[model samples]
Target: MTSPTIVTAAMLAIGDELLSGRTKDKNIGHLADMLTMVGIDLREVRIVADDQDAIVEALNALRSRYRHVFTSGGIGPTHDDITADAISKAFGVECIHEPKAMELLAAMYERRGMEFTEARKRMARMPEGATHIPNPVSTAPGFAIENVYVMAGVPQVFQAMLDALLPSLETGTPVLSRTVRSPYGEGDIGAPLTEVQKNHPETSIGSYPRFDGKSFSTDIVIRARDATVLGAAETEVIAMIEAIGRSREKHQP
Candidate 1:
């Protein structure tokens, strides 16, 4: 049988606020969930400060390793917002004020009766030859160069930028999952779970233990791109749970 196509991506969250714990990161989880729905598996996530060298190094590493690389933060109008410069260095291009972005930002500010200052114009800067990622929340647009998508750091703006960016990307087969709950602990099912995993090489099996104040239970998650394979593996997991349940009953007073 032919294997399903797998498209992978990596995420880079940039800012000293995230590392300092002043700003809680909401982009990584949102990006992961959104990418999974569109069949792009998010393989890695890295958070870096507003240093140019670190940003450039991380961008090069991730872009080389994955089919797509997404970045958030440090593209604002301040001195530390140097993501555009880092991207330009990474791709060997000039970071210039993109005409289209400049037009959009200028128009938005004019309509709002605000001054289009030099600091605001910095929002229009991007690596030359890059495409724009629209931000409906704020008029300052994000930019996409080659396989790297540079987006806003603010959670609302980042999600809006992603909604605009996803349609342009190539997607793979979506992964499906099933969860089975067991009253037993991981200890009771470790060996059997290993056997079930070995029995179905096409599926991924994971056991997570949960505590409910009084005792522990397990949640087994089975994941696969093929529905048939997923169902077969799920059936095996249910049978294993039943067998363990029966054994516990037999030994109980």
Candidate 2:
């Protein structure tokens, strides 16, 4: 049987705090796992300061190269929040207060008896022709223009926005992965691992080394969209490890 087509995606993390080390980013990994579950391969990740030129450049580049581009951060009420404007420029469209977004924000503030100040209203602005990505955690919504999806930077809001947006996206066959942890060091298995990767071109083999202060071990993970290919590759990996074990046992004093 033929393998399903792969859907690729890129992530753009936008915020000066992220770059300055003031705020640690927790969205990329979440998005990666979520996207993978829905058959989208996250190919690239970029972190740009909250600058219009940077955001626009990264957005245009990623949107052109990947099937989807997910951006987190810089979509808030503060003056520094310029993701909406930058996205508009990147798509060559005007920025405006989207009616639906305005209504949502207005209702949210009214419920709390707080004035919908202009600053808070800024959250309603989006690139013209953009579609809202619901934010259940906060009234301010994210948006999607073309292939670029702009989301909140706050972890909770970002997760909520992603959860809402994913259902509407087109997904491919979910990728499957198997991991084998061995007490053997990576140095001992690196050569055979390379051979295994070459033999199984349809699967991706990754060797991750772990050091636990006193000793070293390796985790061999095999990934592929096809279950058959993945199983076959995993078998080869296990056999290679067994062979190495036998060789070591024979040489023991």
* Candidate with maximal TM-score: 2
Clashing pairs for model 2 are: none
Give the per-residue lDDT digits (tens) of candidate 2, residues 1-253. 6859888999999999998999989999999999989999999999999899998898889999999999999989999999999999998999999999999999989999999999999999999999999989977999998888999999999999999999989788888999999789999999999999999998889989999999899999999989989999999999999999999999999
Write the residue-wise lDDT of candidate 1 on 1-253 in tens digits.
4688999999999999999999999999999999989899999999999999999999999999999999999999999999999999999999999999999999999999999999999999999999999999988999999999999999999999999999999999989999999889999999999999999999999999999998889999999999999999999999999999899889999
lDDT of 2 at 105: 90
Instruction: Please report how far candidate 1 places residue 153 from its true position, in Å.
Output: 1.0
Query: For each candidate, what is the lDDT?
Result: 0.96, 0.93
lDDT of 2 at 160: 96
Model 1 alpha-carbon drift over 4 Å, by segment = none
What's each prediction's TM-score?
0.97, 0.98
